[model samples]
Target: MIPSAMSATPQSRIEIDPAVVTAAGDFVVPEPLGFGRCLAPVVFLADYQDGQWGRGRLLPYGPLGLDPAAKVLHYAQVVFEGLKAYHVGGSRPMLFRPEMNWRRMNRSAARMMMPALPRDLFMDGLLAVTACSEPYIPRASGRSLYLRPALFATQPTLDPAPSTTFTFMVVASPSEALASGPLRVVVERTGARAVAGGTGDVKVSGNYGAALHATAVAAQSGFDQPLWLDAISHRYIEELSVMNFFAVVDGALHTPELNGTILPGVTRDSILALARLEGLRVHERLMDVDELLQMIRSGRCTEAFACGTAIIVGSIGLIGEHDGRLCPLPEPEGPHAGRLRERLLGIQEGREPDPFAWTHTVAPLDTSAPDRNG
Candidate 1:
């Protein structure tokens, strides 16, 4: 429901209707909340046509009437981003590295041959939605308001070209972290998440749907996710199905280098920066899966974790290969991953001093809501 306090200031290009805000107030988030399950009652929608983005507005969240032949429907010409808003023990919620998400989203849009979203629209839309949906952001330390910004081709055509018209929308879900504990991942040798000179580096919609088959297979085989290898060699570790991978090898953080196939994740970058700042050795190199398994077996690799917007940092409990081989980490929740998660969460949740200034505060629509607890 639209909160009355969500009215856009005169300086804002985006519009927030009073009626929409009023309707939003009626929504009540249900209990037993899980990640990405409970959505805010409203969303921000902007359209691009005639080679220009239109004035956007907040609307009640609902289904869209897309054409059957829309470019996004047929050709999957769409890209999206995921970020979060935290209730950082204040009346207002804080956004963690939103600018990074905005920049990455534009990168994805560029890769998909879509027009870049203006920074004003992106920031304003995120601020507007997060401000309006502030009450729904869970107060729990590990929970947050998950924000998703997506752009898709809306042009109704069968031609195999980028659509001239596009739709940009921002929707939010209030829930806990995607993964709560250590995960068991399988090594996927058959399929690749992204290929060289492909859309793997961007957050394209097809990139996720393309990996669903491997995820399904992994799940059936009792794995949480699939660790995709390099598309060419199928030996070097590229990334997990959705998150970037890391391992604590010999008291050092080792992750796969950005080899044109890995999504340069904001959390992954933050972890690296934090690790290096703490005087821990960090390496970004071509990590071979076989070698990593051997290292785990030999106790050279003490821990492994996956990082992303949704999962934050998930410890890798076990790594399974295709031929019934399982390599278990000596300590799944080792100090390295635990400390990183703690520090990252502390910064994001406003518990610790933000030395890096990664958090952005968003004023709440209604100040009456109680301050978030530590």
Candidate 2:
């Protein structure tokens, strides 16, 4: 069931479970590559302690031996990141804007009073896991190997201070795009997903946990996701549960500015860059939900979409309120969203030229290569 453990080299700090290649080779790709459902056969793991990071390992994908009183489980000292590895374009897998993810992960760690991840170690984990899972990576146009790198407090202590030890792991999942065509969203007026001066700007574990209740409520109300608002006045539109919000008012793209509450999305940034490069006017300012709805009613806003690592570029067909009032986007699938999604996906999947130099093609580590030790 599980591959064996591994030993690490002092310099590279990368260990390999000899059976990892076999496990990955024997694994089967899922039929309907659901989002993050099919787990790869192997995973990359590392630890942090003694004021420094330890060796990393390529281990079997299995349950972890987490302590019951772990700070992550109690005090919520945890952070995570999501990025993708495309199998198209070349023999080696391609990573889109992974360095941005690394930087953001460290920012989140800093906010949570945790340590920053070294760039080399982070890339090692990503490349190693992606290389090991190459066989199972879906080859379809919109599908990819969804890489989730998570860091958590591992020290077994119930004290109210930070944990002395931490664990980092990178797991791969062969999956399809999170959303397709258009989406139906609900305005979450009562619940605030994130607030200013909080963990809203970072991808910490507690942020998602706090949004679950409202997500459930929105799902029950027949919506795909909830559109979160500012925590204070509840009038300014912050972001969606997992994605950044955007609108096209009078032929110009408008998204809520980064107000220390919204997660700065990688895909959102890429889309903005693409839009600007294509000569589309963009406005990154405080977006009011009521004003956006009014624009939709007055036909001033003709387009709406949300972007994130999961939902690359998802069109918002309609947005509804808690009282069952609905405001449909002027166009269900607008041309702007379609055009932006095409360009973004093109660069991501290697179908088009990467003008921004945003992709990194990962060369698989040779299993047959001799170990560092002679």
Candidate 3:
């Protein structure tokens, strides 16, 4: 049974969908699943209007109706978060550093002029849906129930004003580790993901959409991902399209400093913490592309990688352009990256101790009802 405490409190005025419980038992799990290959059967939803939030509900996954002129459609006022639930060491599903996502989501919402989902509601929405979908949580290490919580404008207007109404929803997917091998990244010089004093620091929808073109171009050119440079001068290395970039130089871990143009990824933060705990020298500072390329050429840069919720820790094998000018890291599978990935994944998968108290475990759903035939 879903835990009663997982439900929203009366003060929050949240409601539960009667159909969600029925749908949970009837939902089917597929075989041979991969990362984000399939979505869970249920979703948690809430709405905001007139300066107040309405009751929330857990509903079966489906499309949402929206006006074509909605601010989110017209002005691109939307933000989202990505986290995961682990089903390791036990049947229960556990979230890793979910509050960080909650806090980051609110920051994005604020940047987009959208009202932030209250912390209680945010946690409740996530826990409620995870509880409902507990049976579907993947049970293997390096596999998880990927949680995505997003908020968007709903008002139908073109006046460039903040939407009077907004919708927030949390959805889940059974996923495996995102990347399989060392990645090849191209140094992007033609496009920029975010500009200074812009929404680059936020997890807004526009940021990802803007990167798709460059990412597509890079992918077609035989590169796994694009290493974006600063939008102002295109000199300093910013990040990968979806993940933060890091390089191991002279045995020291160096990543781009948060310059208000990089998404402060949860996994990125966790890796930094774990690295420090493991006694590695970690530095966050401006990294110039030319200097890094030179270091790689001189064998001074031993390794490079990208980190995010999706691609936990992916080492970079090669870095350069499509014109045959490339520099490869001395050690594609560097000792530091391997150690960090193993340690972090170990904590996430329950194979090691979670000294940071990052995981929140949810009880399994009751399976007493007869399985429904679809």
Candidate 4:
């Protein structure tokens, strides 16, 4: 069951466009909702200026009037987060651990030298957009309402310092889990995703751009994603292009520790907590790519997979080096990975008990009147 929202004063001003509501009412999710390919018809928006944030609103989904000289355009002052809302079998629509994303977003904002959003404002914006978009949330297992909250520098200036103004928006998409089955991964020996003491732990805009080339190159070679190595010593495995790396070695789960370079993913943390509750031994350590490959060859490492908000849990079928050499995992179906994914899906879709209290229920919105504001 979905948990109730916290008793915070709603600061979001709602203004639903008739067209947006009609569009959502008339919309039917395509058979294949691939990742973020389908966007909801409405969005949540707010602004920060004069050293404070303004009131938030639920408005029609559309393009923004970003100036050509906007600070985000030139200086790349941006941070964002990805979370999901689930509504399956006509059950209560709910969000999964959104507070984590809120906390993580503020952490990124702090590192980017941006102002923090008030808790009420964040909650209001998230709930308002999600409530309005509830009609579009997919009701199938592995499908959800993917929510994206982003902050961008809006002030136009040539100064190198942080901008005085910023824009915060929450957009949603009705979609299925990104990627499917096992993934073919390519090891990236060159270039680093993040340095030792950089903005690697946060979901800033620049981090994805830095790893695009590697991912693009990997795709050309028939790989789903790139396996990023550590910045200083390229031997240790850090993470994937979008997800955290995990390997099942000797009946235990081994993942790279959060060493200030890997994004602290909500999905990754959930897996760690759930795995421990199941009495499974989980090790968070620096995994050497070379040693892991040898373990795979020796049959010690039976399975490996990647986990994130979008991908959830994707098994790694094969891992290859830059020289085009590929090594296949014996059990790509991932006996442990499959079990963990089931446990996760159960909790997410309301089929299993949620002991950790991660799911948050969203109240159904009354969109009967287009002019109604809340």
- Best-performing candidate as measured by lDDT: 2
Model 1 lDDT per residue over 1-374, tens place: 11113223322456666555665678787888888998898888999999899887777788988999999989999999999988965556888888899899999998889999998798777887888887668898889999999999999999999999999999999988998558999999989898899999999989899999999999889999999998888899999877999999998999999989999999999999999889999999999998889999899999999999898898989999768888889998767888899899988887777778788887544323232110
Give candidate 4 misplaced runs (Cα > 4 Å): 1-19, 368-374
Off by over 4 Å in 2: 1-12, 372-374
lDDT for position 59 in model 2:
81
Rate residue 323 of model 4 by lDDT. 91
**Model 1, residue 363: displacement in angstroms?**
2.3
Candidate 2 lDDT, 204-308, residue by residue in tens: 999999999998988899999999989999899988888998999989999999989999999989999999999999999988899889989999999899899
* C-alpha RMSD of each candidate structure in angstroms: 5.3, 4.9, 4.3, 2.0
Candidate 3's displacement at residue 239, Å, is 0.7
Best by TM-score: 2
Model 3 accuracy (lDDT, Cα):
0.82
Residue 112, model 4: Cα distance from true site in angstroms: 0.6
Candidate 1, TM-score vs. the true structure?
A: 0.94
Residues 145-239, candidate 3: write the lDDT tens digits.
88899999999989988898999999889888788548989988878998999989999999999899988999898998899999889999999
lDDT of 4 by residue, 204-306 (tens): 9999998999999999999999999998889999999789999999999999999999999999999999999999999999999999999999999999999
Please, what is the whole-model Cα lDDT of each candidate in the order they appear? 0.86, 0.87, 0.82, 0.86
Residue pairs in collision within model 1 = 1-23, 1-24, 1-25, 2-21, 2-24
Worst 10 residues of 4 by lDDT: 3-12
Score candidate 2 by lDDT.
0.87
